[model samples]
Target: MSGKDTGHGTQRLALPGVFTAEQAAVTAAAIAGIQRADGAIPWFRGHHLDPWDHIEAAMALDAAGDHRRAAAAYHWLARHQLPDGSWYAAYADGDATRPTDRGKETNFCAYVAAGVLHHYLATGDEEFRERMWPVVYAAVEFVLELQREGGEIGWRRDPDGSACDGALLTGCSSIHQALRCALALAELRDDPQPDWELATGRLGHALRHHPECFLDKSSYSMDWYYPVLAGALRGAAGRARIEDRWPEFVVEGLGVRCVSTNPWVTGGESAELALALWAVGDSERAARVLRWIGHLRAPDGLYWTGYVYADEAIWPRERTAWTAGSVLLAVAALTGDEATGAVFGGAGLPRGLEAEECCDRS
Candidate 1:
């Protein structure tokens, strides 16, 4: 065997705490086990599927070496996309039925861009990218239409085409990231977006300086870290923001709460916080965040949605496929693991603007 192989050998690395390689293998096996023959991955064993969770499951499949299954999931998305280039918010289990209208959530629709980009990276299929471009383009246009006068984006649009009540910093931040990915994909395919740079800059500026325009959601974890996470805040300002809210949202050994006053900590928020920390180059604290959720992993490798306050065993034990996927993506980023290079190693901040321009626009 090569020297590199000799050093690392074939020993399976343990996840957090008690999870051995054997356990991880079983967890991965279980995820695959839940995947339907047509490529739909249900959130849990025998449960129904939703678009957001389905895409998340597909990502996990890629991480676990089930590219074929992942591709099938993408194909599923492609087949069901609305004429406006969005997927329904939720779908029935196993089969695509009982579609629920989530009223055009920008983040929900934007998420597909990242997944399609990731799938293309994983498979290197030019045809797949070609097929997805029109969907991606139309979706971006749909989100752009929701941008308000002051540069902040509305959270969603109602089914009748009316705007949702207010803006969410977190939702907009996620959409900002997705927009960048969409633009990157556009560039990669030699179909650069004409106004993408300006639109992204406007959104970033609004997030950094125009907090008054958005709803007063400072207590929420998404509001706390999203600016930095979205690449809208950077350098000294980003660092300061995280430091200011660290104690309020972070719950020591349990991870981060979705909101400071809620006293409920969730795996998704914790993992996402780790992601924000990673974006700002704080790998040490990022690792700590990951370790917090690492302690919460079930024997099946899935993660419970949230943990209850004042008691460890009283936590909500329902596993979410997105929670596990977020944790995996965070861990990969923290460790600089090349196997997950595409997902974790994207350009740190959104390109095409200076930090001053991004943060100081009036």
Candidate 2:
């Protein structure tokens, strides 16, 4: 398309009521501006880096054709990966070599696969893919080590290396998608990982049939929509999941609430839910979700994290790289960006294993 949105032969991510080409580039530029020299994108300059959100910002860079910056971000991950194939939970933005938090989150560990796959799809960088395959493979193995007998991943590996008790619905759902992305990488390398396939099926089964097992976070909007967004629930099941929680989480002229309890609606959750809605074939509502969050976009092209409608204020008072990244990605999806659509829409993503094929027998 137009401007810097050339990665993957994608059309300019201009939605009718959402973003024009130049405006979309502005948003991408905002994220690029905040990125550090080492390619780490913290929540804001002062905030610490977390692996999952960091990868999300990197993917957004690739979407906008800032491929070099995106490559540097991935390389940062490679340099910092721990011996166990996991990254420490938080790295100080000022000095990434210093970890502020040492706990390794399972979902955070798994998401490198999704980011690697998305970047490769966008740029078709064979060298990058080759470099990243082992990183993804090791990360997947590390995450699977925490997979419970019931197929849900444990929340995190503590600094002492013990598995933390309990599975998170949102986190596991994200991991479900990551496992599939990892499988795609494995397949491309001509090395099939049947264990990952089985793990994917079991995890999907747990999400679809055994929701009671995950930590009860039903009050959060991410718990409501992440399964669909991550492709763990699809078809009629996915559509029904969206409808069931729509009234509780959606603010009419604003965006999706961060949690059901607050009047606070967040850009990241709202855009992710839009991607989820698009996956479920609800394009009309999906587009509306993006348009509703227009108020959150600042004059500088960065989006505020969330708004407090009850007080009519932008709470937390930060315009974050991840929020802008989520907005860019959702816009790209709605406007027919091929790479964005393929990754989130499950077009070219490898279908791991059917639930019946793997889980029923277990």
Candidate 3:
């Protein structure tokens, strides 16, 4: 099936031995059903809502032909934004007013730019762009303030309002992608943000050249692959990085491990690794990964977060919207969805001034 839904921008989002267009639609509908009346998507029905995963689920909805629900998710972020342009890390799903976690994570705040750009590219909705521009602008500005002298972004601002000390490689790499998306939107509106462009270039430099600037969470697969997945690292360099660590994090018949030391294989990490694999032009391996993780798909159309292969069980014993969201994104990338490729493929996004070209503010 071409996944030619009656909606705009539909395409063949199916992968052989993985999921069909009809099955993809069922998954999308299940995610839409998870949305609260106000459009915030939590981890699941009883779970807490975080800004980043909320947007991930929203982007998946767009991929699967549910743009209305995706737009609603973005609107919810706009409504919940604090005065300083950040959102509290976790909100109680049952009651939006109750914040379960008070820290403001820079990466989580910056992700709205990527999500907004993806939605706009998928739907080409002018009014939606106009409505979300301020949201994107403010959120990007909020995250940029956390950038360090070395170009790595500070991880979070605490509940007491002070910036956290060290930077995370995974988080900074993710911000690197978000900045590109933000700069793309800036150019689209005929309003170029030179500062953002410089920031993007600097962050890319940091991710590529200065791994020491970030805290060494080398045990986690995210820190290993996010640089490639987020577009900071590519070409032969990206391929080598992935190949070097393939043995440590991958479980052959299972998927990518959340941590090298754990016997657990996770859906989200595996799906994200597949996206990174696609980014590096290793589509065959990427498709293999997507197929490998299909065993985690539950009958409800949501994927179980991960399987503890050693224990023969799914730990955390939970299903998450982000896992489902990531799987769909990987499928969209594999199926050659135009918007998915545009955002994740790094061909059309503006590369900011290299770190040498810009005056250092940090």
Candidate 4:
């Protein structure tokens, strides 16, 4: 299948075996409808925006060939950056918005690197990359400021600017991917951030070998699968990790559970798990995982956040742009989009700084 023209001034890319062209167009339109005039995409039409999810939605726009809107989303983030290069945890939904949450999360701050690089990769937009460099740089700096001696990153900073002491395995894993993307962006710009390289190496090391350094959120599916998705573990180790926890988190025909104990299967996690599976060369399983979430798709092509098996209903009753964003990302990865493939499959992203003394000196 080929790309199709959407009325929304974008071409919807088709991903056979994952999503049909019509489905992709519908999803793209759904995302477009929820995007604010300023290009910020909220969780839903009337919800708040978080940096991580906002970037996910923006990348979806890029995947759908809505470059202008994607660029607008990046600009929104750039415009709202704090002096320390971080954003408030959440913002109110609309034009007359205020910060709904004031805490700044390290992973959320760092994810702009991945988003900016994803946009650059998809569009090959040097000018856009140049424009976003400082935004990515400052955000990465803010995140690394929280890195500890043990290599795990502190999770969040309160509104008062005090850092939290603990870290999350999933969050650090996600940040590891962002660090790699940051390095890739630096490479594109003929800039070298040696400190970022070292930080990436240490962060990857902590994620792969030092679970003791992060908070125990083992019951969550993200903590189980994120290392693979983030490229911190690859090949045999990545395969083993996913297999080890498969029965615990996956719900077969339903989808991946948000948490092991919950009777809930979420669209976002399931789609991400599909991407993680694709990262490890398990395309068969990835396809299956993506297909399983078809149950969550609404008539308008937006996806319900999750299904509560206990109640047999959509748990949150909200159709989120990010959830649709995840589906588009997974589709892009599976359908051989080079940029999305690289970001998710570790094709050309930085391998993180090595832990040797030579790396530190360099």
lDDT of 3 by residue, 183-267 (tens): 9999889998988987888888899999899998999999999999999989999999999999999999789999999999999
- Over 4 Å off, model 2: 1-11, 359-362
Write model 1 residue lDDT over 1-362, tens digit each, in one string.
00121112112324455245555455555666677777777676556676666776676565554566667877777777778776665655657665655466777777677777776765677887788888788888878888887777888778787888788888777777777778778888877675776677677777888888788988888899877776667678988999998989999988999878887899888987887888778978887777877666777777888887766553675786777767765655554543344444456323545336656664
Instruction: In angstroms, give how far residue 300 of model 4 lies from its true place.
Output: 0.8
The prediction achieving the highest lDDT against the true structure is 3
RMSD to true structure for each model, in Å: 4.7, 2.4, 2.8, 2.8
Task: List the global CA lDDT of all models.
Answer: 0.70, 0.87, 0.88, 0.87
Error of 4 at 169 (Å): 0.8
- Regions of model 1 farther than 4 Å from truth: 1-22, 45-50, 338-345, 348-362
Rank by TM-score, descending?
A: 3, 2, 4, 1
Error of 3 at 303 (Å): 0.6
- TM-score of every candidate: 0.86, 0.95, 0.96, 0.95
For candidate 2, give the lDDT of residue 286: 90
Residue pairs clashing, model 2:
none
Model 1 misses residue 18 by how many Å?
A: 8.3
Give the worst 10-residue stretch by lDDT in candidate 1. Answer: 1-10
